[model samples]
Target: MKASAGSSSMLSHIAYFAIIILLISFVPAERLGNAEEALILIGFLGAWRYSWASVNFARAIYFRRFAYPREKERAVKDYASRPGAAHAYFLTTSYKIEPEVTIPVYTSVFTAAAKSKGGATIVSSVVDGADERLIRQVFSCMPCDMSGVKLIIDRIPGTGKRDALAKALSLISRNCPSSSDVVVFVDGDSCVPANIVDQAAPFFTNPQVGALTTDEAVDIPQPGFFRDWFKLRFDQRQIMMCSMGLSKRVLTLTGRMSVFRADLATNPDFIKLIRSDFIDHWRLGRVNFLTGDDKSTWYWLLKNGYEMVYLPDVRSVSMETQPKPTFFGSAIALMVRWFGNMLRTNGRALEIPSRRIGLFVWWSIFDQNLSIWTTLAGPLSAITAAIFFDPIVLPAYFAWVMFTRYMFCAMISLFRGHWFPVSYPFLLYFGQLVGAAVKSFVYFRLDRQKWTRQAAKGGQKAPRSTSERLKSYGSIYLHVLALGWLSLAVLYLTGAA
Candidate 1:
């Protein structure tokens, strides 16, 4: 199956590139007049940006393929057979999690830890009383004796995830004595495979590796628009992380599930950083992070010169639940949180010396901010060309979108269970435009947001008075006006107005 999918992905790439070359060659010479020429050039620039991203994505998928380890049973046996092997600890946090999702996640962790040769510890920071009992019940129901494992359930004050995680880290530091122990963090709504320890333990053999993150598959059994969208996000994540893993620098140690060395995770400074980490924005001053706790942890590791790995074979299935009833509403809400997290941390991550991190990873970090605009260039430029240059330009651009994105969707299919959906082309554009717009809004209004799922404000910024609120509105108006004028200027300069 792997071979078949790989071959299909290769053909998709080849066909896409070939189609692009053919389309360019077939353009009518008459359309190359001066006015039409400039508009076409701008449209092609957008196409070029799209082409570069598509190529990089393909390369990333290839690099990720080599990161998955073989002979998994032997690796697990070798790691476990050693005397005085590292003890493994599982730390997870939850808020308003359903019994069905919370129970299976903890159960799987208990089952996996019970089978390991060394002792294990499970720490859960939970908000709901019922979730705590259900998790304890999972521990009690374990078939094997958990004589060596300890279970500590810290009931948080419903402050937020950051607080819950901080509480758990404090508990672990006081109780866990060994710096060499392996600490695995999983979300409340995620289930780890039973062989998780066996798969991840062997990687710690390389002392340079400070942390490891695993591949994920979302469990959204019910059919709906959100289900397919959730799967697509995971699929893209696998390819991107795989590519980034080849360079030994994954952008984020996914909060869904990641393994870290106890020394780094429980360090006094690391714990404090995770609890109150804030970035100094040029305009916003010190902005405390409200979400993206995973990113905070990741940035800490990168700054300290720790190598991070992506284990493609180690799978953690996350439960997918839509917070909003409408697909568009849910997508926007999620992106606001997700992209807001990225934009907030992006500044500090970029400042880390490239010598410590590689050039590829550094450039990739920079690209996140630029991608918002580049991703939208195609539609925006094509529309401008259609309005002013030639109607044929729009038709040609649509043709390219159909052919290239369909092939891109085909390549993505290699990583998913179901074939790529017909709606993917539309969904692709929706995610691109909507995600970029949300990223822009959050970039400016970094202080004005909340964790929609958790029902918590992302920052503790004090409320502004009426006059201050009006000033903010004025700033937004000027920014929007400036952008509109800039667009018109560019169109006129390019002879497309």
Candidate 2:
């Protein structure tokens, strides 16, 4: 069956390519020149957005055969039993996290910490310490005695995640001074597995490894389009992260959970970076970043030449609940915050010395800035060409999209231990179109954002200052004008306008 599916996938790819070639070859000579130009331009735009991910996808497929079982698991166990196994400390931050999610997340981490030779400390941050008290209650109910672990509930003044994390990091750094100690950052809604420590902590034995992150899967008890959508995102995330791990560099140390050497996490400089990291935008000037603390940490490690590792064997399950009732609204809210973080930090992350980041990693960072436009380019260009040149163009483009995305989904599921869902194609288009739109909005409105998960009463200042609001409005219209001009030019030059 596996061989049959693989063969069918290959045949589909061949058929798709053949159709594209036929379409290009059969155009009339008079129209051929314009068609060829349009094809070249469309092809390049498509490949520009896809080529790097394809390369990473290929690398991931290659690494899976040897790396899947993760030979390092036994080594991790041996390392943990060793006399001086690094002391483990956890910094978990919460803001309005549901009780069901928070309880299991703490239970898993604390249960694992109890078995460790070294004691662990949990510095949990909460809004009113109400949930923090609930955490203490949950810790007390652990099936086994957790004498080795201690909990410190830190109540923040209703600030955002950055402040909560900053407070936790500062407290841990002061308390756990040893360079050998390892501090793991966990989200209140993330449920880690029992062997997470045994699998993750051993990597720190390598003195140069500044941080380690694990693979994460999402759990959505109530099933629907949103649930399926979240699952697909995690699936793609797994593939991309595993690919980066092969090179010992990851795009981001996901905020869901990541482990860092105590020295790095505790450094006053690192804390300051997390608290107030920002980049000097050409138009915006020193734009203070409000989100993506994980990116800030990852950039600091990269710039400083600290090696980061991704442990695919250690899986964490994040409990995902849609904040808004409607899927579209909820997804947009999430994307604005997410893309805002990525764009705000893109400038500096790319500037890290090339030699330190390597060619592929550097190109990936550069592509993040370009992809928003490139991914959106195809649809917009195809629509314009179809309206002016030929109606067949749109149908052909849609066919290509369905075929290619289906194959891409199949390939991603090759190493995954589960079946790929049928809803993936829909989710893929949604992500491309909707995600791109959100990125474009945040690209210009860099200073405009808020924590989507935070309560409205948190009383954080609004981002609608007169100057900022005007700039955001101007930026949106300016981009629209530019896009309109570009589309018309493409159509005219290709004889389609």
Candidate 3:
């Protein structure tokens, strides 16, 4: 039954692709004259804007250095000894079932916390059918004492998984002593290093620091080519963006790891806002929740005039996986859901009257939608220049421009001492094409389903996993080429392409 349904979906997708190809082939070349030329010019302008923004963001990251290990230890000792010393509870949220790769890291975190002089309390919240059995199976494998960890396995009625998590945190806050210092939210998949708490401890030195977010780095064993490329590119982009601090007013604190003062979490207005129906809304004035819960929390904290700091030295390693053969389809489905949520969040945000919030709302909209404009501009510009402009010169120039930009990014990735495989540039270009198609499908229709994780393929895979998959799809490319040639021949016979 499942096989038949999967087959039917594949057929439908192929049919849709065929129709699009036919439509594009039939588009009269002459009609692309002026509009295409205009798009090409617009594309150049958009590309220039993106380049400048990226550079400024990169500059910001470079200058904003955090404290070293020894410096951080000193700060932590000072804060721990203060009159009203900040005590933090490590709140770990998990769906009863978690990935096997994360278990070891979670155990390591508990071990580190136990060794800390200040002593951190652990709150493990589990939902659904996830209970003592599942937790024991995963946690027992780790060499850590589970006695200090407080576990809650209660079921949440009439709420989604994410909502249940928020509720659990809220409940935890209510039960804590009024004088408790801080509440640090950490995803189950993330593993905190031994010195992470010490590094982050200093941010509390500033009375205004309501929350602090650490830089997230991924750790994977024997990553495939595409996975390595993605990590390098993504890390560089994130680092550059963080450095700029352009979106400081609306900076997204990653959900994987962040610490907030307990007092802020106990705020009546904040708790009310999180628990309200408005939380269901996608866009909250100047606060965007497009990326997920972390963004929503960051938006709320910033809007309330609370200071949020980015502590690069406070690092946590997260486990990640590469996209499989059906990656494009999955990507489109996920992006559609995210884009719809973002649009909804933006709408909610516009209701706020604060000027700073208003600017943030508008900027978030622009920044998030930049890819859409660039994607459309690329193809339209290419086809238009091919029609009216000096086809040879313009097309070659555009290709060179794109290649140069990609090469520069690749170089930067390498300079950052991250993995930049030889075929990374090609993968980057392919990724852009995939993104354009996904974005187009998303904007054309709204999808309101929660994103589902794809199950990993069984069996051990080679390090060149993506490359192997590409080779496997080589036959499909041949079939596509044959079809393309047949279509072109038919077009010529009918005087079309």
* lDDT, each prediction: 0.76, 0.77, 0.54
Q: What are the RMSDs of all candidates, in order?
A: 5.0, 4.8, 13.4
**Ordered list by TM-score, greatest first:** 2, 1, 3
Worst 10 residues of 2 by lDDT: 455-464
lDDT score, candidate 1, position 264: 76
Say which prediction, candidate 1 or candidate 2, comes out ahead on TM-score. 2
Please give, for residues 1-497, the per-residue lDDT of candidate 3 as tens digits.
98996777567545644644555555555654534445456456557756755565554445344323343465567676676534556777665434475466567666656544455666666554544456556556646555554545445553444565567667666656333366677776778776655566665665666777766678656556545554654555456444533333335566677777777765666555555423332221122222256656765776666666665545677765433445455445545555555544454455555575546444545555556545545544454455544344344435444555456555556445553444455456555555655554433222223434423121122325764455335434654564455445433432234
Q: What residue runs in model 2 are displaced by over 4 Å at the alpha carbon?
A: 1-36, 47-50, 67-82, 456-466
Per-residue lDDT of candidate 1, residues 1-497 (tens digit) = 99997788568656756766676666665774534644565566666666766766766666655434443344456666667767788899888888888888888888878766678888889888988888888899888878888888998788888888877888888866464578889898889888777678777766678898988888987877888788778877877787788788899988888999887788988888889988776655567888888999999989888889888767899997888889999999899888888888888888998888998899889888887655655466666766776656654665677676676677777655457655565577677778877876776767655876776775434445764475466547755864576467557655676
Error of model 2, residue 25, in angstroms: 18
lDDT of 2 by residue, 1-497 (tens): 98998787567666756766676555444653445656667787777657777888877765555663463664476576678766788888888777788788888888867865677788888886678788889988898878888888998887677888888898987785576778888888887777666667777767778998988888899878889888888888888887877777888898989989898899988999899887776665567777789998998898888878877767888888897989999999899888888887777777776788787788777887778777777787777666666656665677668767877777777767775656677688889888987887778767666777765321123435876656666777877886777667677755665
Please, what's the RMSD in Å of model 3? 13.4
Alpha-carbon deviation at 203 in model 3, angstroms: 0.9
lDDT of 1: 0.76
TM-score of every model versus the real structure: 0.87, 0.88, 0.68
Clashes of each: 0, 0, 9
Question: Measured by C-alpha RMSD in angstroms, how accurate is candidate 2?
Answer: 4.8
